[model samples]
Target: MTPSQLRSRIKDENFCKNIISYLENIIKEDLSWINPAFEHLISVSSDMESTIFGSVSNCIEDKENTKHNLSDEDKGEQEYFYSGKM
Candidate 1:
């Protein structure tokens, strides 16, 4: 998925809630199988949620900061071009 999609999905409370519900069902329906797999699955999903949340938060917090970072790189490139030194 694109970053925007990932961010949007993570930000949707309903989506996260649905995931929680689904996970709960898995735990309830087949504790035997889920017990062995739940930890890894939960950890991976939690990590994914955190990553997506962070990216969205960052995008919202500092849209200009992201742009500024790129511009700084551009400035360096211009300097390199002017100096004729790779």
Candidate 2:
């Protein structure tokens, strides 16, 4: 999330400004289905008092599960997500 975007959504508007880049990087890695982000999230997640990592993990897992469970008509959506990750 960008600092400005996060500021609009979060109560402590200014707090995320410092860690926005970290969040963005981790999101990119997470979307790419890489293990590093979650693997190291525990050691560095002290900055996040929320369940951001857990939420991200769940979202990715849901995506993978949906990909496997999709019907033919829903299959095209997977390509859209894969291209976006690229």
Candidate 3:
């Protein structure tokens, strides 16, 4: 027997955007979410070392992906923060 079709991810750009916005609102409401939009951030640690960030050309260029970018002059990296944003 052979498969009749291929499985795929959600391709609706607008629908996906709505879902993401909904999720973002949920996290911001009850959780300790942090970012430029939040005031819950702590000061950088004294022992924290500088870091070099890698470029995310794919996500930055992909129109279907969430439209946001988070970067710092020092350390690089979260999605829930994606490791860097988090």
Candidate 4:
């Protein structure tokens, strides 16, 4: 189901209680199966985080390299503005 549909269902008191009850039963009886699922979720989350951070780091590096290539006069102007001397 879509996120919006899932959210609407969760808002219903009965559905929420049913889900909680089901999870409790699963935890009590099927914890062995849940362990692999939890591990997979953790691995996927870690991979996504590293990918996002790596992209951001590359963008920042590119911006810094561009700034480094600026002429001395332009660098001085940028420094002056950043130093609140503008």
Candidate 3 lDDT tens digits, 49-79: 2221213455555623534443552224333
N/CA/C clash count, model 3: 10
- In the order shown, the candidates' Cα RMSDs to the true structure are 17.3, 18.9, 21.8, 8.9
Say which candidate scores most in lDDT: 4
Ranking by lDDT: 4, 1, 2, 3
Candidate 1 colliding pairs: none
Give lDDT tens digits, candidate 1, residues 1-86: 89898778988899989989988997778447557778898899999999999999987788556546667778788678769897
Cα lDDT tens digits, model 4, 1-86, are: 89999999999999999999999997788457578779989999999999999999998899788997889999888899889977
lDDT of 1 at 78: 60
Poorest stretch of ten by lDDT in candidate 3: 46-55
Top candidate (TM-score): 4
Q: Judging by TM-score, tell me the better candidate of 2 and 3.
A: 2
Instruction: For residues 7-71, write the lDDT of model 2, one tens digit per residue.
Output: 67676646666568678887677455556668678666765645787788899999877778888
Candidate 2 colliding pairs: none
How many Å off is the CA of 44 in candidate 1?
Answer: 0.3
For candidate 2, give the lDDT of residue 51.
71
Off by over 4 Å in 3: 1-9, 31-86
Angstrom error of the Cα, residue 13, model 2: value is 47
TM-score of candidate 1 on Cα atoms, chains taken together:
0.37
Steric clash pairs (candidate 4): none
